[model samples]
Target: MHTLPGARDTRRAARRVQVRIGGVVQGVGFRPFIYGLARQHGLSGYVLNDGDGVLAEIEGASLDGFLAALRAAPPPLARIERVDVRDIPPDGGKGFEIRETIHRPGHTRMATDAPPCPSCLQELFDPAGRFYLYPFISCTQCGPRLTITRALPFDRANTTMSAFSLCPDCRRDYQAPGNRRFHAETIACASCGPRLSASTDQIASALCDGAIVALKGVGGFHLYCDAGNEAAVRRLRVRKNRPAKPFATLVADLAAAGLVAIVDPLSRRMLERPERPIVLLARRTIVAPSVAPGLRQIGVMLPSAPIHHLLFHALAQEARRRGTSAPACLVATSANRAGMPLITDNGAAHAQLAGLADLIVTHDRDIENGLDDSVMTVIDRAPACLRRARGIVPAPIDLAEDGPPVLAVGAYLKATICIIRGREAFLSQHIGDLDSPQAIRRHADAIRRMTAFLGVVPLVVACDLHPDYPSSRYAQESGMPVLPVQHHLAHLAAVAAERIVRGPYLGLALDGHGHGHDGGNWGGELLHVDGSTWHRLGHLAPVPLPGGDRAAREPWRMGVAVLATLGRGDEAGRRFHTVPQAARLAGLVAGGAFPGTSSMGRLFDAAAALLGICVRQSHEAEAAMALEALATAPRGLVNGYRLNGGTLDFLPLLAALSQPGMDARTGADLFHGTVIAGLSALTASHAARLGVRTVLLAGGCLANRLLADGLAGALRNAGLNPIMPRSVPANDGGLSLGQAAWARLCLKDGTRAGIPGYERT
Candidate 1:
C-alpha cells in the first residue's frame, strides 16, 4: 500500500467507501472499467452490476485519486447520471475484482444503439486481426443495446445474444479483464456469431447494377440503392410508391457526405452524435436529381452498422479493380409501405418488400424492437429533432422535477409514448401515425416494451383531447385513471417542460391541425399556460375548409375555397378547370356548408395553390415544403394583415397571391415574410397585455426553420424570451412529452379525472 504524506503507516490513512452510480451503467463495461480503475489507484475492492446500476467499494490510502478518476473518466459508452458514496471501515482486501450481477428493485436507463467505435473500426480494417472485414464487429464501446435487449437487468440471458454460445476464442476474450470485449454482453466473433446471408461483394455488385436491396440493420430493414443512378432511385420510388418524398442518403464517411451536402458546424455536431441521426443539410450536386426533388436541402447520414462499412469497402475495391468511380452515396430508406410501420421480421420483410427490393440481405439476429432511423435538422442554431427513433429512443430525458409515474399516449399523427418515473422521462422511438390497425398495434407494443423495461406502472394515463383518436381511446381503455389535456396547451407544456420554465408563459402554436377544447378546428393559436391550468388567448383568423380533411391533401380545394371566400366564386371553376372537384368545392364554399380552420398549414396550402406551385401533395407537408424551397426574394406586402382583439387575419395576403400572373417564387416569399411579421406582432401584443416575458413556440408549422428562426429573432427584438423545443420535436412526435408534463401537474393538483376545460370521453 502507498504511504500517506503525514502518516508513517499506510493503514492509518486507508479508507474504504462504497459508491452507488445510476443511469446508463449496465451492459456497457461499467464493472470492468471500475475494476481497472480501482487497480490503477492501488485500491482493493469489487464492482458489481445491479438492477439500479453499478455499485463499487474501494479501500486504499489513495481514496481521493480513485474517486476523482471515477468522476473524471468512465467507459466511453457509459453515462453516469448520479453518484452516491458512503464511508465504510477498511476491508483490507488484497486485489480489485469484478463481481457477478445481482438483481434489485430500482430504475435503470437504457442506452440507445451506437455506431462502431474508432478502435473497432481499426481492427476491422487490419488484415492481421481476427475481426478483419467482419461485418458484426462490436465491443463494450459501441454496438446494439436497446434494440437487442428484451428486458431490464441487461444481461446476456435477457438479450438476443443469448442464442449464440461463446466459442473458445470469444470465451477467453470475454473473461480477460484486459480485453476490450471483457464482460460485453454482445461478445462474438465471425466463427460463432450472427452471419450475413449474402457476401459484401454480391451486395456491392447488385447496387452497382442499379438494384435496390433490402438490407437488415440493427433496428429494421433498410431499402438502399445507388444515389448516383437516376434509374435506380426512380425505380425504387415507383416501386415503393413514394413518388416525391425525399430519401435519405447514406455516405461512406464525412468526406463523402461533404461531397453531397454542406456540413456546417451545427450539422456536423448532430451528424457526429453516437446515434448518428439522419441530418438535413444544404444540398450540393453529388446525388441524382430524383433523390431529393424540388428541395434545396437533403438528408444525409453516415453508416450506422458494420455491414455498411464492409459494403462501402467492397465498393471502393471495385472502383480500383474496374478503373471507374463509385457512387457518391446510397439512398437508404425505411423498408415499409406508405403509412405503415417499419418491417422488422425476416419473413415479413421477404413477404412485403418482394416487389420493392431486387434482393434481400439479412442476418440471423432478431430485432426485439423495430426502430426507424432518427431524423434531425438545425433550428435557431441548435439541433431540432424531426423523428426520435433508433439511436435516440429508449434513452431517458431528465425532467425538471420529480413526479409520480405517468404514461402519456400521444396524438393521432406521429405517435409516441412517454413513461415518467421520478425525474426522468423515457420517450419511445418514433412510432408512425396511429391511423392504421398495424400502426396502433406497434404503438401499443412500444408502450408495453418501454414500460416493462423501465419497470414503470403509471398512476395515471394521459392522452390528447380528441376523443376519437386511437391514442385517446387507448388511454381510456388502459384501466389507469385518464387525464385529458388540450392539444395546443399540451404543445406549449412540452416546450416549457424541455426549457424548465418556472412560471406562467405565453405560447405560440403554429401547427397544421389539432382538436380544440371547444370542438372547433384549430392550428394557429396563442395560449397562456400555468401549471395545471391554461387559457386560449388568440389565434389566426379562420378560413373555410372545403371537404374538411381532404382540403389538406388537395391544395386546389383550399385555393378554390379561398377564392369563394374572397367573393370570386365564379373564378374558381375557370381558374382550376383541370381539377374536376374545383367547381364542386367552390359550390360548397359558396353555400357555407364547410367547416372553418385557423390552421397556418391550410394558409400555406392556399398560397401554394394560388401560386400554382403544387396542386396535389404526395406526402404530408409536401406543398408547404415545396413553397418554402421556391422562395428567393421575400418582400412582404405592407399592411397586408388585420388584427382584431385576438385574431390575426391574412386574407389580404391570400388575396394578393390569388391575383393573376403571380409568380410562384414571389408569392411564396411574400407569404412567409408576412406570416412571420404578423405572428411576431400578435405575440408581442399578447405578452405586453399579459405581462409575461417568456414565450414558448411549438407545433408542426414551427418545423419550418425559416419561420422558426424568424419568429424567434422577432420575439427577442421585442425584449421577450423565446423558448424552442430542443430535446423533442416541434410536431406531434413530441406531443406526448407535453401531455406527460401536463399530466404530472394535474396529478399533483388532484385533478386525476381530467384538467379543467378539457372534456373527458
Candidate 2:
C-alpha cells in the first residue's frame, strides 16, 4: 500500500480505502451527490454503480470525515441501508470521476416512482423552454423508476429510456457537474426524446366533451371522464362492470379538490404529497351522485405526472373560451376488466379498452412492472395506508433484529409476499384475490419478480394456518422449511411489527373469516400476545353459517341464522319471507349441518339485512359499508348484551332488531351502539384482569370508519392507549408482514419451545 509521502510515520497516515453502500441508491442521483461531496473534500477517487450498490475508492487526508458526512446527510430520495468499508492500496489517482456502471449477480434496492418536482413544473409552463408542453418531461428528482427499470445498476440502457436519446442541450446538462440533470438517467428533451402526438389532443378534447378516455400512465392505463358529468361517469361504470363501488377522482390541485370534497389539514397534506395516493375525504353536494353512490366519503387525489398537468391546462383553456369554469376533475379508475390484472402494454390496453373507452391516449415507453395507485385514510388522527403501491412500494421496512432469510406467502385476499433479508423486509405490491386463474398467476409472478430483484433465497417458508388457502398450498408444495401461523395471531403481529410494541397487550381481531385454533371459523377474537406466543382470552358468541359460503353472500341468510341462534327458529322463515332461501336456510339451521363462526362481519351483515338496507351483496363488504352509511346520527338507545365467562352474546340486540315498527336508520344506529358498548365493556373487564393498558385494533372489519372511530374514542375515554396500524394495512394485505415477524421470533426462541403452531418441515 502506498501512503502519503513523509506521512507514514504519522499517527494517522493518509491511506486509501474502498466503501460499498447499499439500499435504494440507484436512480436517485447518488453518483452526482458523491461527485459533489468528493470535490468538496478535495479527494482523489472514483465512484461507480454496481449490482450490489455504489462502490467508491478514496484517498484523502480527511477520509474519516468524508465517511461521516456521507452517512449523516444523503440525498433526499436516497435511503442508505448498509455501508461496508475496507482498506485498499493507494493507486496515486489525481482526480475524482464517475465511472461506468458494473453489472453483476448481486442485489440492490429499487426506488419507487416520484412526482414531478417544482423546477420541472415551472419549466413545463415556460413558453421559451425547450420542453414546454412536453408530456414526458422529467429530471432526477421526479419521474418513473420501478415501472421502467428492467435490470440492476439502473442505467439508461437497462431502462425503457434507451429508446429516446438526449438532445444537445439535454446532453450538456447531463454531462455538466453543476446541473441538476447531471447523471439523470431519464432526462430527455422534446427535440430528441419521446414526443407528444395529435391523438393526445383529441383525447383531451373528448374528456372535455364528457366522453370516457383511456390514457396510459406511469404504472398502468387509467380510464378518465369528467367528474361533473353524471352521464359519462355512469356509462363508464356500467361498461367497467362496477355498479356500487366508489371510483377515485383526480383533480388539478388542492383548491379544485376542495370544491367537491371536505379537505382538512391532514387530507390536504396527503393529497399534495409526492406519493399522490387516493385520500378518503367527506364529500360535498356539488359532486355528481353517480361518483360515489350511497357513500358519505369520496376518494380524492391530485395529478402526479406532467401529462396530467397538460390535460388539465388544455381543459382550462377550452373552458375559458366557453365562458365557464375549467373541467378540474376526472374519474381516474384503473383500466382493467373485473377481477383481473391491470393493463400495461399499449396493444393489450387497445384490445381490452376499445369498447369501453371513446378514445385511447397512449405512449411508446414500456412499463416493466404494473402497479395500482395507493389508497390512504386518516385513522385516530393519523395517516393509515390501506393499499401500498405505486410511489410507496419496493421500499423496505426495518425489523428489530437480523435473522435468516424467510419468504412469507400472505392470505388469499389482498395477496402480497414478504422477503426478509438481514434487518430489512421487502414487501410486494397489492396482488388481487387469488380466486381466478389470472389472479393466481399474477400472485406467483409477484413472488418470483420480488425474490429475483432482491436476490434472496429464503431459508424458511411461512404461511397462514388455513389449509384451503392457495398461499398455504403454495408454501406446502415448496421443498423448504415450512411454518404455519394462526390467522388472528398474524393480524396482531402485523400491528405489533409496525408499532414496535412488545406484547402482553390486548388485541381485537375483527374481520370476515379466518381458520381458528379450535377448527372453527374465527373472527371478532380477543387475544393476548407476547413475543411468539398468544392466548385467546375471549370471543363473540358463535352462530351457525347456513349454506356455508352462500350465507356470506346473502345477508338475509345470516339474519335468519341469528334468529335461530336466539331460540326463535320458528320465526326465521316468517322473518325473512321475502328471501327465496329463507325456509331452506331455517331447515338447514335446524338440521345443524353447517359450521358456526364468530365473525364480526356476519354480525354487520345480519344487522344490514334485518333493517332492510342490503339483503344481498354483489361485492365484498357491501353490507357492512351500507350499514355504516345508514348510521347518520349519534348512537341512539343501545340495546343490552350478555357478557358470559368469555363469550360476548348479542342475543338481546338480535331480539330487539326482530321487533316491529323500528326505523331502519335508527336500527342501524342502535346495532352499532350495542356493539361498541358490548366490546368496550368486554375489553375493560379483561384488561383489568390482565392489568394491561394497551389495546390493538386489527383485521379487515376495522376498515369501517364508524366502528374504528367509535372504538378508538371509547378506548381513549377509558384511559387506555389504543393502537392502530399506520404504516402497514390493517386488512389481510399486511398478513405477510406479521407472518415474517412471527417466523423470526419462532426461529429465535428455538424450534421445540412449545409454541402452539410452530412446526418445522
Per-residue alpha-carbon lDDT of candidate 1 for residues 1-761, written as tens digits (9 for 90 to 100): 44234322444477889999998888788888888877776789898888898888888877776677777788887889899999998868899888887877668777779899999999999999989888889999889998899887878888898899999999999999899998988988889999889988888888888899999989999998999999999999999999999999999999898999998777888888987899999899879999999999999998888888998999887777778888779999999999889888899988899988999988998999888899999998889888888888777778768988889999999999998889888888999988789999999998888788888888778899999999999988887778888888888888887778878999998888889988988999998877677888899999998877888899988899889999998898888888877887788888989889999889999999889898898898999999989976555689878989799999999999999988888888899888988998899998999899999999998878888888898899999999999879899999999999889887777654443334332
CA lDDT, every model vs. true structure: 0.87, 0.84
Could you give candidate 2's per-residue lDDT for residues 640-713 as a string of tens digits? 68899679988788778777777888888888887887887788888988899899999998888878888888
TM-score of each: 0.97, 0.93
Best by lDDT: 1
**Which stretches of candidate 1 lie above 4 Å from their native place?**
1-14, 89-92, 752-761
Q: Extract clashing residue pairs from model 2.
A: none
